[model samples]
Target chain A: MKRPFILIVAALTLLATAVPALAQDATPTPVPPICLNYVGQPDDIRTSYYMGEGLGYYASGEFSRAINSFTCVIFEIDANYAPAYMARALVLTQRSDYERALEDYTRAIQLNGTDLSGYNNRGIVYTLQREYDEALADFNQALELDSRSVVARNNRAVVYALQGEYELAIADLQQAIETTGIDAVLADLLDPEREEGTPPIRDYDLIEAQPYALLGIIYSAFALDNYQAYLRLTGSNGDFRIQSAAGALESRFTFDLRLDDGTWLLVADFAPEG
Target chain B: MRRTGLIGTRFASSLPLIILIFLIGVFTAAAQESPEPVATPDPSGVTVESCRELTERTAGALSIRTDAVAPFFIGLGDAAFADEDYTPAIEAYSCAILADPTYAPAFMNRGYAFFAQRADPLALADFNRAVELDPALALAYNYRGMLYTVQGNFGLALGDFTVALTLNPDDASAYNNRAVVHAAEGNYDLAMFDIDSALLIDPEYPAVYATRSAIYTALALIDAEAYRSRAGEAARYPNGSPIEVMGGLESAAETGSFATWLAFLTRR
Candidate 1:
């Protein structure tokens, strides 16, 4: 199963129309990939709500409903809206409809290739089909486009390790940890290169700020190697914590961890305790 | 306001649905300690009031500082899974569930978190609630089916797999997962047939090949009477587990990541 991450760029595309900016580069390129919110007056703003509703549905784990909602937005407003297709494609992927997911990813790319998510996401589908060569190609392009993208680097490292290229995998992991020390997996990945004076990776941040540590510590306690703590904390003690981003500027996550016999148990009922 | 489960039997049940909570019976007398006020949205819930009340107070007890508890727990769960911190993520999700019994997504999400953590029982409970809260949710059934198959519960596995399949015919996971149960039951023909079915829907799926390889093994192992060594060899080594030679399935499955999450649901 593909591990789900905090979907930012893709969420933006799905939530907002995400049109490209109309600025010209000194080198005579037409327009950059950076776009503004939906335009053309008050009527278009409704599209944004439809998109947000779709994202919320997605967040709530209702993929099919989210697809329908997004499809409705597409049909009701701009049929060419890429987010609608992208959102639907995500549902298709959950359904294991790779060809269709790939098709949508392709269209998403064609609609806006500069945003590295399209290539990176398509690459994931290719990897699922064991199309490593193709998966590698996509990861390569993704890394090329955004060299700082820790997710792409970490994923590429996984591909490398599966191919038995331990060294390459280690290098990629090293770089990923260096670039984003806040990555849970990177921290979980015990590397030999840490002794080589590697710089500590940066923390995960929100768009509003440089990055608030990504609160990644809540995620990396698995390999900590304890069993009793895991079993002790595995179940809900007849209660849960409820929380949200609430559009807050700070980055804090409600987190608890336990180690249960070769298993890492974590509980995160989001609330802004802090 | 209402316990999501049965309202009659539970002493300390904390569900958004009242009926299911009280059905558990033994936890009923201790309802007063549950932390939330139990509202008898329906007339039959007198016993659940004290129990549900305790659950509610505890559920809403997150301090302002603890306000990030649920989402933090959920994010931590996913992140922990990504980092292979399965144990910690499991704890995180469980806490999230406790914090809000009404949080259906927490149960579903935590169920997946537990699966990755290899904690089958916990995962089963989460998937159970996820499906219970949303009957048309195909992902929950598909997951529960896989868990059942792993335990060799073919009857249960088949039921869930069938339910999932009915929900989404094109879902390769539902097909591949059911195929394993078939293979385990010595029905190589039916098992291999499912693999073919999955591939038909998803030509590029590498997991199907891994699954098919297992079917090849089952065929070669059990169909010894029908095929001589040569025939057995043909059936089993039809390119030797396909993807192992191609070096694709594991890596491909890995790439799915968050990029490929689809849930099959009815129009509702």
Candidate 2:
């Protein structure tokens, strides 16, 4: 009786595994729609032409006409086109129509969850509305989709900074700089034997500079906060000076505070170290 | 004994409050005036020059070639365009295109002529053909981007500007155009970044300053609206006048000193 029971149990396990294998063989996995490179064009030639016309209107700064053209692309041709929704949402965002923009962005995301820009852009809308938790969640999801995305990291840092999570903000920004290769380019720029007429900057380098600028602002705020605390604790009348070095960089910042005739004077200076 | 004990307890609790009040008074007495720092100079205001005017001045350098006939016609077109004669410019550019159908610059220049005359469709066709003829022609992309921008096709415009920049990283006009598109899309952070890059490339570029002023004005208005919405009926002014608020915002926009403006608002 025990041997018969063992044989039945083994047969049942094999049937369960074989059934799933057969089902897997019968059904094919569906591919997700690509969103990042979505240029808002449709397969139909007429829709594409209208999309081009709408883009022309948008480029011309006739936002109302542009919006109308995009709407035509949506209503007249393909309602399921994610790019149209994304484009219309962009125009709505520019107009500060946050509600409609949110709706459009949400719709675009629904149509294509694979597009990281959808999440990043929607996160921006949330950030603008002061919906920090929602923004963070969107950013986190975006990061989960693409770990190396500098835009998501930078935007998430901004949200974190808004929420007063300074350390987290700093970490994210540092990661952004790393991912953007700003440090490597800066190192190359600092080389003394480099060829002449070679530009020390690129368009993307400007983007990388944002992190450095943000870091400076954060450090400045820290200096001010510390100064206030020092004043509260010591009640000092003498000039108070704090000097700090930027992380992993040769730049130094000095914050000076002086009291003169019942007035406080503060000055911050950035001096690069040799 | 109970009354004495209660008095001691009350005194102990009030001691920290007394100290806190004393500290606040001392700080107030010592810092009667706000902090003083060097002020940033006011930047130039927005320029009245149109986008086309700006682009024409900064348009990509005319493509030089060894072909004599096309170059001659191109020279004629350049002269006419420079003189603001759109008809002759268009005819000359057409002749250049006829002389060399594959010359991307001819198409781009003719497109410019058509654009000058407000013949957008013709200009777009020429620009499109120019891009098709030479995918690497940065000027063609720039002109087409400008046309697309005019036609309200920002996605294509952005694509064109980005392509132009990738082809020629030193093109300050491309940076400025991309900045304008970004600003229009409500991506102020990206807009500001592009503007800074443009200024770095060409500090004397008037269009960049204009773009910066526009961005600052937009930001000031947004901040003002937020302040008003939050303050509601309890809004206060520095001098009890609404004009002061506008004045402060204008000053902030002109000077590009948002921090100063925010401080002014908080003080009110």
For all candidates in order, the CA lDDT equals 0.53, 0.62
Expressed as tens digits, the lDDT of each residue in A147-230 for candidate 1 is 987666656655664464556766766676567654453553356656655554544443212122222221222112122244
All candidates: TM-score:
0.34, 0.39
Model 2: fnat (fraction of native contacts): 0.00
> In terms of DockQ, which candidate is strongest?
1
- Provide the lDDT at B139 for model 1: 68
Clashes of 1: 98
What docking grade applies to model 1?
A: incorrect
In TM-score terms, which candidate is top?
Answer: 2
> For residues B1-268, what per-residue lDDT tens digits would candidate 2 score against the true structure?
6534544565466457435533543343234343222221111111223322322231211101112244445554554565576775666556555555666667788888888787897888777667666666777778888888888888777777777877788889988998898779776656777788899999999999999889877776666667678878577643334456667667879888775445454433
Number of the top-ranking candidate, with lDDT as the measure: 2
lDDT of 2 by residue, A134-154 (tens): 988988998898887777787
